[model samples]
Structure formats: structure tokens, C-alpha cells
Target: MTLETSVGNTQSFGLSSKYVEKWEKRSSIRTRPEKKIDFELDGFFFPEDKQPVLLDGRLKDISIENKSELLIRSLFKYLNDIVTLEIKLINSACNKIIYNDLPVAYPEQIKMNAYTVIIDEYYHVYVARDLINQLKARYPYLTEDALPDSDSFCAVNEIMKRLDAEHHDLFEIIAVCIFETTLVKELVEFFKSESVHPSIKNYVNDHMNDESRHYIYFLELLQYTWDRLPDKARRDIGSNIADFVKMYLNIESEKEFNLNYLDSIIADHEENKQTVNAIYKGFEVTPDVPIVKNVISALKRTGLLDDENVKSGFTNIGWII
Candidate 1:
């Protein structure tokens, strides 16, 4: 990825007028088809591979009816997660940039791009919620209550505890930068899967459209911001990136959340619930390496990984090794 570090004599950041102009043509909000998309009720709601419970061999013994129910619930939960990510975290960071609430100064063009991003993100939230409502209408029996904030949702608290109040916004920006840079790849599988409904693929496609641009924007923002910080400030931010990455990953929280979801789906089936509990205990603990690698790649692209403290932080956490 092409990234800008210093602003020497140049007025434009990475988001030049040419790039911003493409948003109108490429953004889903502007380019979405006017016709309503129809769904295939018989088709899978979410890809089976993406849903861990569906992949577990022990769960295959469960009735197909139960499995079907879990799949639909998974869709609702995923939609809700998207809503939480957009409204709570992504938009919050964008608001800081657009409203001049951050400690660093951004060029006007970068700020303008943030305005477009906020609009795109809000539109994504709308699209996700719309799909949920449509699905609920079809399956009135499957009710998905609002899930508790995810590990990523609450990651800021654990991260903030390590930084001074003065650095809060800055760290939030960096955290968001890392998130935006890595999230697109996670969505790609959903878009590419033929096992899922067409509408679902289209939804993922729309999201990926915006996110492709967002990752670049955040990368540029990271570089621009990094270049402006003093040496001491850079060391402080660099040393803590590992902690931020780990908290954001939060594998244990995700495991617990998925287990709770499974338990809820099979609440009345004592035998199956017990079996699931046993199977889950043996489930492999693995980080999403591609996503973590994207973070590492982002750091490398922005030249943050050159800092010994930053590189060591990742190495110490085993994210680098």
C-alpha cells in the first residue's frame, strides 16, 4: 500500500482529490440498486464454515432442525455485531476526526474523506439492520436479543487503562486505524462463499466496497499521525500496540460468547448441551492469523514496526513469531 509519512511541502495526504472523487461512483449509498433484493429462505443465512458450531463434529449429531435454527440465529448475531462495531467503535472514531476532537491535526482532505466514511459506515449499519428485520419477518420464531458488547467493543476500556487521559484519543485513533486496516479481509470469505444466499453476498460486497477504501485511509492517517509525534510519544504508543492488539483479539471472550450462544440455542436439550460443552473444552485455541498478519502488515506499511519497542512488543506477545 502506498502511504504518506511526512507532509513536507505537499498539501494533500494520501486521500487526494482523485480518490475522494471515486467515492461518489463507488460507494454503496450512491451506487446501490434501487430495486429491493429478494432472499432465498431455503438457502443458508450464513456460511457454515464461518459458524463454528456448525463445523463441530459433535454438533452434526444434533437434529437438522436444531442446526437450521442455529444458522438463522447466527445471522442475527452477526448483524447485531456489525451494528455494534459500526455505531459504537467505527463511528465514534470518525466523529473524533470530523469534529476536531483529536489531539493531532489532519489535512482538510483527510477530514473530508472521514465525512464520507462516516456516511458509508452509517449506511452499512442501515443495510445490516435492514437485513435483520427482513430475516426476522421470515422467522418470527427465532428471536435474537441484543448481544452484550463484544470483546472488540469493550477492548477500548482495557486498552485505555494503560494510557494517560491525554493520550486517550490518540490511542483510540491508532486502535481504530489497526481495526480498519485489517477488517476487509475478514469480510471477503462471506462475499465469496457460494453456500450463502445471494443477498448475503451482496451485503458483504457492499461492506467490502467501503472497507477497501477505509483501510487505505486509515493507513495514511496512521503514517501521517506517526510522522507528527515526538520520539518519546512514538515510543509510548509503539510499546503499547501489542496490548491493544491482544485485547482487540480477545479469543477467550469470543469463545465464551459463542458457547453461551450455543447453550441458548440448545437450552432444553440437556444431552446435546452437555455434549457441546465437552466438545468445546477440546476445541483448538487459535488466533485469526490472517487478521493479525494484516495488523502486522499495516505496521510495516506505515513503518511503525521499525521502532524496536514496537517490534519487541509484538514479538513478546508472540504475534510476530
Candidate 2:
């Protein structure tokens, strides 16, 4: 089917035709030759002795002990605080920017619907925090304030800022399309895993449904933006996407062992340092296999990781194991 026809059908499913058309156009744009980016994995895994401490379920399953319960409670409080901060940040950063750029003749209904989607995402995160608290009450050891913090969010913000500052027009489009869409989908899936708390699973699943729609919105936006760019600008965006993929992959590598993440835990003073250290050490030991393999697998399954352009780019960067 033609791009326009496919988009029209998608609009029948509740998405805006304008948005779908944009995505369709961007998908048609020619991608640049992929370049390989060098990535190192030498000290990636933690020590084996650190395993038990890092995987300690006592804090996450607090019902077994008073100490664990207290830790769980503290964690919930911290998470609530962090979620509130995130809601505010997203609102402030996204509101004016989205509305101002929207077409002058954009229907109020579409605008309202778009705003609702953003608001729902904020609430979804909030609900996830609440579910974490519920799980903590039942399984204190399973509950830990292990969620990312304002600073963690800031890291993403910094990347966005840099993209905007350096690349301008294409940053929002590509950031939303290639990066945010995929990351949110992966996060939702990660949370829904059987290993996670039931409450957390349910909460994440609910959010995932909304995120799927948002992902489509981003894809549409990307197509629209690409279609409007000059040939040179389109090439620049392709280059930017190549650079961003490398940067994003490196950031993902650190997710397995970021010490700053440990700061959010609300464990006892004595246990905190030990637990954090153990967790850090646990992550230090490299699995017999390469971590990037799992990452690449996920990317491939998502239909975004194995694109010929991206593969070529990584090859050029010497990312092959």
C-alpha cells in the first residue's frame, strides 16, 4: 500500500493521520552508509563474591523482618518524591515546546488528545511508584528504592540538550523516534518480566499500552521532520542518528553497573554501603558471554537494532565482538 493509504488506515485506529503520514515519509528517506564506532567492554562485569549481596532480596521482600519493612517504607517515600519531581520536569520541558510547534490549524481535539497522552505517561510512572510501595508492604525484601533518580533522568535530558544545541531541528524528531520510542518500550517489557513483583508487572503493563501509542506518535513525527529537511540536513540527521546510536549503546552498557543508582536505595546505614559495594562488585564480573550480545538481540527483536545502516555504522566503529 502507498504511504498515504497506510497512514489513513492507521488513523482509523485512533492515531492522527497527519502524524502517521509524517512517519511514513521519514521511513522512506534514504539512510547514510553505516560507520563502525569503537566500544570497549574490558572491565564490564563485577566480582563473583558480590553476587549474594547484590541479589539480596531481604530489602526487596520486607515482610519477613522489621528492618526490611522499614527499608521498604523508606524506599517508597523516596520513590514518591522522585516521581513527583519527574512529573514536574516532564511537564515543564515538554509542554510549551510541543504546543508551540504544533500546526496553527491543529484541531483542538487532537491537541487535547496529545496532551492527555503526555499526562497519562506522567501518571503511569506515578502509578508504578505506588505499585512498588504496595509490593514493599507485602515483600519488604523485594522492595528497594532502586528506581532511577532525577539525576538519572537528567542524563537523558543532557543528551537531549546537547542534541538540540548542536543539531537543532532534527534533534527532537530523532530523539523521540529512534531513542525514546525504543527505550520506553524496552523499559516497559523489562518491568513486566516474571521476576518483577506482580504489582509492578501490572503497573508497567498498563503503561506499556500507552507507551506503544506514544512510540507510534514519535515515529510519525520523525517521518514528518525528515520529509521537510533539505537533502544536506537529512544527511546530517542520518549522521546524528549514527552518533546517537553509539552514545546510547555506551549509556546502556553502564546501566548494568552504575553506582549512582545505588544512592536511591533506602536500606539501613550499615547495610547500605555494604549492599551497594556488593552490588557494584557483583556487576563487575563479566559473564562468560558478551553483554552486547543480549543488547543486540533485543534491538534485533525490536526491528531497530539490526538495520543495515546501523550495522554498517557499528562495523566501521569496530563494535563487532
Candidate 3:
């Protein structure tokens, strides 16, 4: 199903028996391409504009081969992040709902759909890995151990560390809700980039198809949980949304990581090292505007942003004006 048709306004829909049936039928695992996707000789592994250091235009002397390495490595890091998010964060929270381990009971339909989400998420991991393996076959230099660390998973762990043990699962659900919602937007950018390889684009298309459904499911989950959460729990989770956004979107740290990695790639050349340092000195990390917008919209739609504390926390952090 197209995103426009699949996702209506979050407040307007409920997870009914009919919705579950449709979701399962259209899910990527059951319906997406089964054959291995192969890349074209000329297309990029990742978009050049999406890479901040490359986009900066100051590193004109960088070789085409090195730039390709950066792009391919960026793709590997992106795929690795999907593996981290789906298996580590989303599925873990889905397990909680499926097993009825949360502080409150979700609707029967919502619980049933968690099973579908787990299936879809695992399929996403499979698809991402398939692409990673394909890339590795061509670029023997790209190894799993060399991929960049996942900022999202690390951020989630830090958030969980601050919460009481009882609220850990609850916060996981909240974090995944924001993640799945924002992810739909992020994937669209990937799918639309013409410079990226067709196979990569196709993989993103398949993943986005599943993510669109997951987005609605998590929105429903958010509304259900927010209404039933005790006041103290609500305050605890709501108050931390801003902090979570900062860590999860750690724009500066991510830029630093990318620049440092690029420096490592060109360490032998003194002039290139100086250029990398200059680029890092000049580059600034800004919040992903579209993602930040979607996150706040999800919170508002679910009424979490209605709480004075929640709204105030976001406002103080400049996410809300």
C-alpha cells in the first residue's frame, strides 16, 4: 500500500481486526522481492549530499576511489544501524507488548499486531544484511568490525540507565514509538535519491513499506499507553523526551565521528589530513529538521505534549517554540 493510503491521521484510526488482517497481508516479509538485488556499475552506495564531509565542498583533492569508499562505508554504517534499531530496540519493546509485560494492558488488536511488527522487523534486518553482504562481496575492505557505532542504540541505553527498573520497558516503548514515526520520513529520503543504486533504493522501498505500517502501530501504542499510564509514570517518561531527542539526534557527535573516520581513511597524506581538520573546524551539526518535526508531531498527536512538564521540557530545549 502507498504511504498516503496506508497512514491516515493517528487519532482517527484504531487497530481493529480488519486492520490487523490488512497489515499482515501487505507486510514486506510476505510480499516483497525474494530474489537477490544486484547493483549497477555506476550508481552510488550512499548519496553524496547525505555525507556531510563530502557535501562541504572543501575537500576537492580527495580521490574518486576514496570518495567511493566513504560512500560505501556510509552505506555499511547505515545498514548496521538498522540491525541495531530493529533487533535491539524495536523487537525488544514489541516482545514486552506481545508478552503482556508492560505496566498496562494494550488492546487485543494492538497486542496481536505486535506479532506482525516483530516479523516485519526481523525481515528488515534480513534485507539490510543481504545488502550489506552484497556490498562486501564487491568491496572486500568493508568489514563488520569497521562500521561506525550506532548512536541510536547507545542513546536508548543511556536513557534506560536513568529510568527506574520498572520504567525501563515503558521508556523503550516510548522511544520506539518516536523512532518508527521518524524513520518513515528518513526512509523516503533514501528511496527518492536517484544517485543511490537501484538495489539499495529497492531495499529501502521494501523497508519503508513495512515501516509505514509500523509507524501507525506505534502511534496507536503511544495513544493507548499514554491514556492508561499512571501520573508518576507519565511525568517520568514525558519529562525525558527532550533529553532523548538530544542524545538520539546527537548531530555534533555524529559529525565528529564521521570526520574522525574520514581522517583515519586518509591518515598517510599530510595535506589531506590538514584539509580534513579544516573541514571539521568549519562544519556545524544541526538537528535533522524533518525528523524533529515528525517527532514533535507524534508527541502532540498522542497528547504527550499536552502535559505542561513535557511541553516545557521541549520548549526549554528549543524543540518547541
Candidate 4:
């Protein structure tokens, strides 16, 4: 595997653009289109601990307490953002810059790897869309608008709107790359999580396969970006990046959505208001959560956190411990 530690690519294969071909030749997921993609839902979506909130069902009706049904339904909704927004981030903006912009800016290193990223990201989007179609066919409630303010949707939109229009694509690349870095970390846990649905787990495993190759590319891309920039230019972006990270990754909106989500399900069941409130609390975002840790870890890896201004921004937001 090729990696950049701020010093440079750990291996020559990456900088020379040979790693792209090497990865293409070796990746089963890339070469094996015939491999079956399972769309079956395992009656649950996420690990219980990661759910918005949990109620001790022993106090309620067994059917209602099962939560298996409700959570699975929610997962289907969340995939709308998970899969499609990822596609949008990659296809809509990030890949475009890699294909058109990066090559022009850094021709020597970006020639092949950037295009490879475009191809692989599209494949991932296809896989997610396929799964979503299967899920919608199975569950009628899996609408596009089912879950508002999904993590991906929120993060992507926030960053896109924050950057200058002329540089929106470049900033979009940064936003998605940040998410991808964190995603690589989250997927590691997803692989280890026995509680994940089998179909979703396998799907994640496939996406992880490709992402494992890509995260370092973006990490290095950021490095390449900083190395090439003038001090003032770098400083400008550094400060902006800090603000972007804080605003884009906000979880308060998701918490509010999760709380309201209960209202939709409850349908004026006033008796269950307290139960819903408990679930609302579970959506609270903390710096220590696996997902947040991934973002921090990825930032540290980029050496982006080394910028005192950037560090200050994250620190103020309570994003980094």
C-alpha cells in the first residue's frame, strides 16, 4: 500500500502513477463484475449502540420493543444519503476536479490515479443504488425524503455552500475526501461489527475494498496541495478548512431530525413521549464516537491538524479531544 506521511509517498509506485495500474490488476472487486451483490436486509441496520436511541422494550409491547423492524426501516432511509450522496460527491463534483483540474495542476503525479478514482467511485455509487432499489422494493417507506439531514447529505451540502463558486469543485473534493477518510475508519468497525446486517456488511466490505486504496490518495492529494501552495494561499485555505470542518460535520441537526423522526412514527401517541425522548438523546454526537474519531484521525494523518489555526478551530468546536 502507498501512503504519504507529509514527507512524501512511502513508496515510489504511488508518485510514479504505477500504483493505479497495480491496484487495478490486483483488485477482485474491480475486476469481478459477476460477483453477486446481496440485497437482503438482516432485519437490523446499525449496531444498537450506534442507533439514535434505544428503549428497554421489556416495559412495552414485545412487538413494539423489538425495534428490529423500525431500525431496519430507518437504515433503508439512511442509505438514501449514504449511497446517493456519496455518488453525488464523487460523480457530481470530486471526480470532475480530479479528471479536469488536478491533472492540469499536478500533471506529473495525477495522470492515471485520478481517473482510476473516478472509475472506482462510480462503481461504488452503482452498488449503493442497486441495494437501495432492492430495499425500496422490499419496504415501501424507503422514500428519498424519508430521512432528512443524513450525515453525508448534511456534510456535503454544508461544504459546497460554504466555498467560493469558482473553487466549489475543489472544495467539494476536500469535503468528500474528508468523509472518505472517516468512512475508511468507520468501515473498519463495520467489518468487525457482528451486529450489522449480513447483506449490508458484505456491501460495506466491498466498498471498503475499494476505499482502502483511495483514502491515501486523497490524504496525499492534500499534502500535494499544501506543498505546492504559497504561504498566504496555504494559510487562507487552512483557516477556511477549519471552519468548514466544524460547520460541515455538525451533528445537532441530525439529533433534531432523529427526535422528530420519532414523532412521525409515534403519530400522536402521547403516552410514548418519554420513550421517544430517550431515543432522541441517543443521537447526540460526541467527539469520541467511532465516526468522529475517524475524522480526527484522518485530519491528523493529513498533517492538516498540525496547522495551529486548524487545530484551534477543531478544538473550539469540541471536535478533537
Which numbered prediction scores highest in TM-score against the true structure? 3
* Backbone clashes in model 1, listed as residue pairs: none
lDDT tens digits, residue span 208-317, model 4: 77777777677666655555554554454555665565555566545555555566666654545566556564654566666677777767766778887677766765
Candidate 3: TM-score? 0.87
> Which residues of candidate 2, in runs, are more than 4 Å off?
1-97, 101-113, 125-170, 183-189, 192-195, 230-237, 249-316, 319-321
What local lDDT does model 3 show for residue 276?
A: 51
Model 4, poorest ten-residue lDDT window? 1-10
Point to the candidate with the largest lDDT.
3
> For model 2, how does the per-residue alpha-carbon lDDT over 1-321 read when each residue is reduced to its tens digit?
123211223442323555434433332111112111111212111122222333555445534334333333433533453465436443443453356553222344344435655565566555646555455555645534454433334434555654434444344434444543445645554444333334334444555555566665544444444444555544444444444554543433233223333444553655655665565454421212343344344344333343455456556665662
Evaluate residue 141 in candidate 2 and report its C-alpha lDDT on the 0 to 100 scale. 55
lDDT of each: 0.72, 0.43, 0.73, 0.60
Off by over 4 Å in 1: 1-13, 34-41, 55-58, 141-146, 265-288, 319-321
Give the TM-score of each candidate: 0.85, 0.50, 0.87, 0.78
- Per-residue CA lDDT of model 3 for 1-321, tens digit only, reads 111112225333435465578775898888877736565556777888787777445456787878878888888888888898899999999898778566777656677778888888998898888778888898887777745567678778888887777888888988888888776867678557777877778778878887887777778677777777877888887788788877786554455457666567656455555555666574422344666777777877777877876877777777543
**Pairs with backbone N, CA or C atoms under 3 Å apart (clashes), candidate 3:** none
Query: Which runs in model 3 stand beyond 4 Å of their true positions?
Result: 1-14, 56-58, 268-288
